[model samples]
Target: MCGIGGIWNRDQKTVDRSLLQSFTQVIAHRGPDDSGYYFDDDCGLGLGHRRLSIIDLSSAGHQPMASGDQKYWLVYNGEIYNYLELTAELVALGYQFRSHSDTEMILAAYQAWGYDCLNRFNGMFAFLLWDSSKQLLWAARDRFGVKPLYIWEQSPNFIAFASEIKQFTKLPNWKAQVNPQRCYDFLAYGMLDHTSETMFKDVWQLRGGQYLTLNSDRQDADFGKLTVKQWYSLPSNQQDLSMPEAKQQLQNLLKDSVKLRLRADVTVGSCLSGGLDSTSIVCLSDQLRQESANNIPFQTFSSCFDDLRYDERQYIKDVIAQTQVHPNFIFPNANELFEELDHLTWQQDEPFGSTSIFAQWCVFRQAGQSGVKVMLDGQGADELLAGYTKFYAALFANLFRKWHWGKLVNELITCRRYQNATEIQRMIEPLLPIWVRQPLRRLLGYASETAVPSWLNGSYLQTLGVTPQVSAKFALTTPTSIHQLSHLQITSTSVPMLLHWEDRNSMAHSVESRVPFLDYRLVEFAYSLDDTTKIRQGQTKAVLREAMRNIIPESIRTRQDKMGFVTPESQWIKHGLSDRFEIELQKAIASLGQWVQPDVLQKIFQATLDGNSGMQGVIWRVISFSRWLKVFDVKI
Candidate 1:
């Protein structure tokens, strides 16, 4: 809902007001209504904020908001949905508020509870707080990583942070360089889910569910010295709940979560795709609409690809028939929007190769033109619940590796995920850990960053010298490092793609979008479910589908494929983008020096042209990285 940026100087110089101004100006689309700044010379802290004003549309909500005694000043991005409840609790504990803004409530809550306040917050957020009384600076992102926070910490005096990576460019002496290791991760898997390491050398993304406490003094601000801690983590399975119980609980949680997010002074709408998640959200939202009897009803926007096989128009029609919500279509033709590519690339702080991002961008653009300020989306359901087919495949493989072919084949045939039980059993043989597979289910996850490909045997993402532990850290659902999860095929590329796309395109037209499915509590609740229920009985999200049995259509709710948001990159590479592919590859090779093997690169490009899907992964990585460099002036 906002863009937060600031700098901390150790040796207190006359603060460069323009630097702060530039930081705020670049991300104006994030918070277009107003801007605020807070500076403390003694503490060497300067905070800049651009407010989108979703919660409270009043001047009282204007931020760089300070506490009652002006002892703490804060700039935050995201909504604290439980602000009212927290406010009542805070007031009970002698904390007072003058503004009816969530921002003000955050300042008061932090003052009363300090860092403990984060545990009580239930919404998405990334914020920086300067404790005037204590001279301490704190920055924390949400538990689910709904919002983004980027930081630059080369030296203490140069410690800076921003809501978007582009805001970092506003700093006085910023330079752009690719962290080679990050590029390697991108090539390995379309995301870099590690800590602070971005495509830009010094600029780093703050991992979700993590916080930073740093000193302003350059000499004292050693990363080695600061101890960053995570307030929350996703435990594999701490609860011993049954699948039926989980399905019912998930349904209730999702409904209530949607109910809370339905709160808006302006009109509410939703992003609907042919998939079960989006359709389920739309169905539930429509039911809420019917109960409210507001007569306003809800609106639905869906994206359409040129390929009929991938298009979900029939599914959208099914939902529309039942709910009768006014549905709009945002069609994306790769050939047509190639011109918009440069601008769309710029919206993302780092480079993103997925053309599906542009498709999401088109959805928000339509949302803005339709006069809707907020929209709900089903973004994180896959990661939280076991929606991807790959999980089961991995599980089956893991079992087979332990000579449990009987159990593995039974699962494969029941899940109906693969053909020929013996073939699948053979395929899964090498996947087991040296240890037992029945208990641990050691398998090659479809999202495994450490799993090297045939062509990727010596790929840079592996040899570029980052630890597989680091790679694994990024791939985790919980927060340790931000990069891994951010780029998790589910979270990194898909979730962030929708978020950044919605944020920019909606803001471009002065509309604000909200996603309830992405609520941290919902995310936590989903991740907490048993993996067995997620991909059970030859069904992905087995519990999730059952939960919505009465709501979403049987066809959509029972969908077997886990195609969330994707484009035909292979088709584009060969026919549509042939010329652009040639030019971009040449540029990437020439401009990026020797980061990738040119022989391998040409082979990859030719493979795409020849209909081989093997190189699609690395080609997209190189192309996305190359395009990012060309646009952002970033270099290796």
Candidate 2:
């Protein structure tokens, strides 16, 4: 994977070559190996690229690559795992290749199928393709947005696209202004990356499964004239398959996905958290390696903690023993996190939810240091399957709505026995009336759909016309089945933010991270199965567990507890880093200005430190936002 950027002056003004180069240089870390530029002065368009040299190490892989006829120029990021297969098909269709790179495959496929080529691609990508003949610019992101593409429209005449938001800061007339609505959603509801609108005003992202086409031919065109369309969507169709049939299909799909992602010139490893999702990947990868007789001990990276409450060393050991793979570990502490907080916030390009992101950053850093260029992670599995504990409530609600009283009671008993699910109130809350559920949720310290947080400046929010309501996009209603809930999480709520963090963290270290579970085929297949296949017998990712039954160790395969990667944020805020956290909190309050009530925020922090409130997430958001403002010099 690499970094890509482009500028198209719709008014036909000459494109700034140096400024385009600066845009490319800003994200140099994303692709440190090489850089290239393509300029079309006649059309007032420039495309810049930074190469990480993953698939093809030769200069032949160099990009801002062109078609055989040189009619189309493309600046692309991300690897097409199935490039070989597509290449064979394209060659059969008389398409010739100059390089053994996925980048060339994209051009050939597009030439053969036009926009329909997006449906055939099976990888993470965010790319800009300029059709010189049509004077048309086409941009698209992957089906799950594993890659990032941000758009900045300075005016109708000036439009730019980049792999990261920070690239826009280098523009000559650019000023950093905060998008208040996104900021409010972040501070109040912990919502981010859920919509195309970003934290920066007038900047938007090309979301997953979507593409944009901008025609310079339009005489009076503006951002409104840009045609953005959804090319992919989650499959809502369900299949009636038996447990055995579903298990076998899932196992095959996951294995094939892993095999495809393994097609890389550089060394590839995995991020193993010792949870079911990650361990299953490690074991499957190890199995694949053995099958191919590639006995070089597969490398794995992990984040460990000394604190037992936050540690997964035991589970990590279990996987290592089973797989016999070379393992690398990093111990991330509060002090280290604080020291790198500013740099981390800058790398993320926006405020993150918790310190768990730091743990992940540490993992990628260790991998980069270990010379692993590509790391396969288990991110999309949880969202695609009903892996979160909160999903249990949705499962229960679905059963109740269907009048499956016997099944619901059995599930409740089994869940309590195996998973130790004690949130009886939440599990049954979905069955209650809206009026009853809202107050109960508030009492549990969860934000109601319409209740504004007391810490937020209500008057300031009103002035900005920003409503402080939690997004119901992922909410569980009476009709919301587990599949529907999973779909929501995958599309709008959880997976988007997770993928955002994954992309930024991995790319920050110049490492390509792949998620096999996010393969569209695997996602569709998983969604097609019944909900029981996902979370049966109190087991989350039940189908995956059963699929890897004999392949992975039974201990890890049947694990009910889930902790992908965690940091001791609450503990640190209360004890070791309390002073530093307090200092940052004060600075954040000062930086935030009227956006937050200083007194209220301070009380919340104090209560959290005293172990009287569970507002560490809020405190972290405030601190993260403050650092972001300073790093980007954003105007509120």
Candidate 3:
């Protein structure tokens, strides 16, 4: 994977070649191997690329690559795992290639099939193609949003796009203005969005599953003038199939997805958290390699902790005992987190929700140091397959809504025995009226608290303004059924947030992270299955358990407790980080007084100091936001 940046002058002014070079240099870490540039004076468009050189090491693979006869130019980030198949198909249709690179295959496919080539691609990507022949700019991102693409418009006529928002800072007129509404949403509701709006004013993230087309000939264009379209969407049509048939279909899809992601010229490894999602990736990868007579030990990276409650070493050991692959472990501590706090915040480019993201950052850093270029991960499984405890509520809600009382009771008992859960409140939740239950859920933090936090300055809150509903888009609207919930997780909520963190963390270390579970075919197959298939017998990801029954050790396969990438944040706040955290908290209050209430902030800090562990997360977010402000020198 690599970083892409470019500028298009809609007013047909001469493009600044130096500006492209400056912005592209800012994200050099994303692609350090080589850099390329292409500028067309006639169209006033410039394209720049930073290459990581994964597939083919030869110069033939270099990009801003032009097609023969110079009709098209392309800059791309990400791998096309199915390039070989597409290449073969294209050649049979009279297409020719110069290099054994996925980039070339993409160009050939586009040439042969035009925009229709997007539907045929089976990998993560954010690409921009300059069709000089058509005098149009075509841009697209991968279906699952595994890759990032940001767009900024200087005016209706001039546009700039990049792989990261930081690249935009190099523009001569670039201003770092804070988006107050986004800040309010983030602080009040913890609403991290996957929508078009970004934290920075005038800069926007292109939603995943969407593409852009802009005409070179259009004069004095505007944001609305760009023809943006959603080409991909999660499949909602349920197929008529038995559980057995669905399981077989899902098994085949996953196997093929894993095999395709294994396509790389450089060394590949995987992140193993000892949870079902990651363990399945590691074990399945090893099994597939063995089947292909490639017996090289697959490298697995994990973060372990001294706190047994937060550690998954036992489950990790179980997977190791069964597969016996090469393993690498990291003991991430509060010290490392504190030391890298500012750097991590800068890398993320935004305030992240939790410290669990640091554990993932450490995993990617270790992978880079170990000389692994591409790391396969299990990021999208939980969202696609209802693999969280929260999904249990959705399941019970469905049963109660359907008047399946006997089934609900039987499942509750089975869950109590299997998961050792005593939360009877969940089983009784569906019986309450929507009005009464909704407020109760919000009070318990089961729903996002849209009410302004007690810590916000009243003046600032009033200045930020209020609406009857400012959070409808960011709110995780409760789904009607377990299937619909899983679908929303992929389309709107958890998976998108998780993917954003994974991409930023991995790319910070210059490593490409591939997620097999996010393969559209696999996602479609999983979502098509009945909710009972996913959470069978009170086990989340139950179908996955059945598919990997003999492959993964029974101990890990049947694990009911899942603590994926958890950390000792509360402990750190109370002990190891008390002094520094207090200092940072005070600094944050002073720096953000206009937006934050100093008295309320002090009270929150005092609560954390008084051994209220839950209050530590609030302190962390304040510290993160403050650091981000200083790092970016942001303006309100």
Candidate 4:
């Protein structure tokens, strides 16, 4: 809901007012309504904030706010959906407030419970709190990292934190330098934001469920030490529950999450992709609106395409017929996407996987143009509920490993009847030993996990000691259960990258995007359910369908095809944008230098253009990385 930045100069140099302002101003698109600043000359610390004014739009909501005793100064960049509830509790404890804002609630809570206050919060947030009396600085991100916090340490004594990495460019002595390992990871494995280390060298992010603290009053040896620690983590234990019990609990949790996210001063809407995750939110939100008698004319936004192969207009219409909602749609064309490629790349602050991100960018843009400030989206459901088809492989592996032939056979039949089941090869691939599978993949001309891509410069990667493989943090060699795979995806692989896209795309237009499904209570409960409850009769998110049986239209509740904000990347490469693709490909090969092989990449692009290959993802990476390098003037 806002942009926040700060400077902690441990050497005790007076913080420059203009430099702090520059850091906050660079990301003004995130918060354009108001700005605030605070300086502590004695501690050599300063905080800057750009306010979007979601919860309380009055001047009282202005940030860089101070506690009643003026002991703590806070600059925050997200919403605490439960702030109203927290305020009531704090008031009961005799705490007074000057502003009707969540910012004040946080200060009062911290004054009462200290760091333990984070355990009581249930929302998406990233904030910096300066304890002026103690000469201490505290920073923390939300449980699921729905908000972003980047840290740049020039040295142990001087550190800067911001909501976006672009703010670091405002530092006087800073230069943009590419991190080769991250570049290789994106080009070869399509990974971004998978770890704390970002694509820029020396720039790190505070991971989700984590916090950091710095004290200036310590001994010389520990003076500049920044202690980072985990504040929350997913529950490792699963709960045993009947199917009926699990469905009711999930429905209740989701409904409450949606209700909490709807607590905003500005206009709020939902992102409808016609898929189960998004449709469920829209339908539930409408249901809530009618029950509460809040007639603000609930609206929904979606991205559509003329190409039916890549469109979900039919399903979108189905939902509209069921709910009393006003629907808006945007048709994102390849020409428009290319026209704004540089801007979108700069907004993202790094290269992304595919044009699907452009589709999302268009959705947020449309929402902003329509005067919607906060939009609820469905992002975490897929990871938590095993919505991806690839999860089917993990389900089969779990059953086969346990030697449950009866269940395995029944699942295969159900899957074939209800789902595509075209990934049967992948479903059975996990059963093969690694030694045998590696050789078989090689025989099929497929690259193994350790094998470097032909288009990448193997020698350059070797010199940098960069192995072109998936991050071990996300790699599950052999997942024994859907829960294990869900844990990995939620923690490292999918949710982080998706959240990155969600934040940037929405904030680029000053829109606040919320993910109700990522509420800690809902995420924990979803993960605790049995795999059968998630994927039953071969349908993904089966429990969600049953929970919304009458709440949503039957057509949508039983829908199977999974396409959330999908774009026609392959079709564009072959038809509408072939010339542009070739031009960008050549520019990338020339500008990328030793990091890529020109001939190999050219052949790959040509193969895709000729409809002989399905390497659209690789092609887009090349185009995106090239533009990112130019947009930020990154030094290779």
User: Evaluated with TM-score, which candidate comes out highest?
Assistant: 4
Per-residue lDDT tens digits for candidate 4, residues 352-382, read 9999999999999999999999999999999
Residues 243-338, candidate 3: write the lDDT tens digits: 677677777888899999998888889999898888988988989888888866689999998888889898898888888589999888787777
Candidate 1, residues 600-626, lDDT tens digits: the string is 678778867888644665666666777
Off by over 4 Å in 4: 218-221, 418-421, 443-445, 469-478
Alpha carbon lDDT at 554, candidate 3? 85
By TM-score, how accurate is candidate 2? 0.97
TM-score to native of every candidate shown: 0.87, 0.97, 0.95, 0.98
How well does candidate 2 score on lDDT at residue 231?
Answer: 92
Off by over 4 Å in 2: 218-224, 419-422, 470-479
Q: CA lDDT, every prediction?
A: 0.71, 0.88, 0.82, 0.89
In angstroms, give how far residue 323 of model 4 lies from its true place: 1.0
Misplaced by over 4 Å in model 3 are: 218-224, 418-431, 438-450, 466-468, 609-613
The candidate 4 region of ten consecutive residues with least summed lDDT is: 469-478
Global lDDT of model 4: 0.89
RMSD of each: 4.9, 1.7, 2.3, 1.4
